[model samples]
Target: MTKNCFLKESKSFFTLIAVFFSCCLFAQQDDLQSETENEFWRNVQFGGGIGLGFGSGYTDISLAPSAIYNFNKYVAFGVGAQYKYLKQKDYYASHLYGGSLIGLLNPINQIQLSAELEQLRVNVNLDGSNSNSQDYWNTGLFIGAGYRSGNATIGARYNVLNDKNNIYGSAFMPFFRMYF
Candidate 1:
């Protein structure tokens, strides 16, 4: 065959393949959008937690808001935002802001298994003769279980990377959650 004819046929073959794949991609995307629009509202839940503490020379406060999508009776995926303020007189004060990815499983009635990963920015200020401040990112992973009653869940989690200097504080933390 002539060189020009061979090149023309090759170009046509490549163009056909490209068009086929593009159509397939768009078809898959449309199916996904249709499913998402079907019962999206029924699977959505919104709620979170609030924490407060007081002491002679220290105070702690936190607010966390979360939303979840239940995939089935046994599985859920969620996201949340966290904000915390800590102050210690004559010592230091800090602000924590972060977000988290959460997962849950219900193996039986009233029982839930939970896990979460959080990434936070911690800003610290020291009060002293020579004051200093700094900012950094902290990440934490927690795993635990909870008891669910109606719209409330009470649980205790252990942070795998918890340390005194970690913005999340203790290794063992109790949590309260509500869903609407």
Candidate 2:
């Protein structure tokens, strides 16, 4: 009779342990599912923007092409190039070529943080000279928040650059972005 009791109790203890372990496994699976639901991927992006120049007295239009790779759900890095045209009244039209690095702080959700660094080259025709031109190169940094839904994204950035040629000071730039 004692042997029977001992065997029964041992079986019950093992059954309890098995139940506990199974519950833990289920919880871990749920956590993994949540994580997979929130991941971003690397892909191509194309966007355009319009902004007012702080000192150049013009409205600028920019075309940007970017490629991004997400390390996880919350972080990504990208590189891209931009072409900008600025029309200033009574001054030479300026063309800008820039390369940029972008960082996405939250790559998975609708709301995210973004930061960018750009190296820009500006070219303008010289006044009263038929064959003369002026060029300038500068660096810019921008930071802001963004919202992404499906393939569409919208964001606003504050830009800071060295205005050595008195071209542009600190300014606010709002942009629209699309990815595929």
Candidate 3:
């Protein structure tokens, strides 16, 4: 074949291959998008909170971490772990560890409602001359409402099942929830 003809054929061949691969890539884009849209892990979020307080011979520390799966625009379900350490000078020391299951609902863009069931194993050691340790479990069922912003909510929840064994002196707890 003539040199010019050979070059022309090669260019045509390369151009055709390029176009074929380009079309293949573009076609796969839709399939990838569709698959990821329904991916379970992709729709899951991680969030939680940490707290610390100190006052004259008194100390409090807490950590709670959680994960949730977004069912849709308005609903999510999650699990969480909690740890708390409290010490009061010449008073007592306590350790609280637990887990929780949480359900969340968003009826509007700015409102979030939640239900949480938590069970904590509490161990306390009384300070001073006659000191002793007590251990037990505390269970709480909380219902709460909050003002919601993107990926976060601030609210308070009230425990409906508060009894003598409950460690938190009150049945009300303030919360800040977030997800990433």
Over 1-180, each residue of candidate 2 has an lDDT whose tens digit, in order, gives 699999999999999999999999999999888766654322334443434455646667767778777676677688888788876666667888889998878745898788889888988875567577778886878888878886666888877654545456546777676655
Q: What's the residue-level lDDT of 56 in candidate 2?
A: 47
lDDT of candidate model 1 versus the reference: 0.90
Q: Which pairs of residues collide in candidate 1?
A: none
Highest-lDDT candidate? 3
Per-model C-alpha lDDT, please?
Answer: 0.90, 0.74, 0.93
Stronger candidate by TM-score (1 vs 3): 3
lDDT of 2: 0.74
Q: Of the candidates shown, which would achieve the greatest TM-score relative to the real structure?
A: 3
In model 3, which regions exceed 4 Å deviation? 1-38, 128-131
Residues 28-59 of candidate 3 have per-residue lDDT tens digits of: 99879888886978889999989999999999
Q: Candidate 2 vs candidate 3: which has greater TM-score?
A: 3
Please rank every candidate by TM-score, starting with the best. Answer: 3, 1, 2
Give each prediction's root-mean-square deviation over alpha carbons.
9.5, 10.5, 4.4
For every model in order, what is the number of clashing pairs? 0, 0, 0
Q: Any residue pairs clashing in model 3, and if so which?
A: none
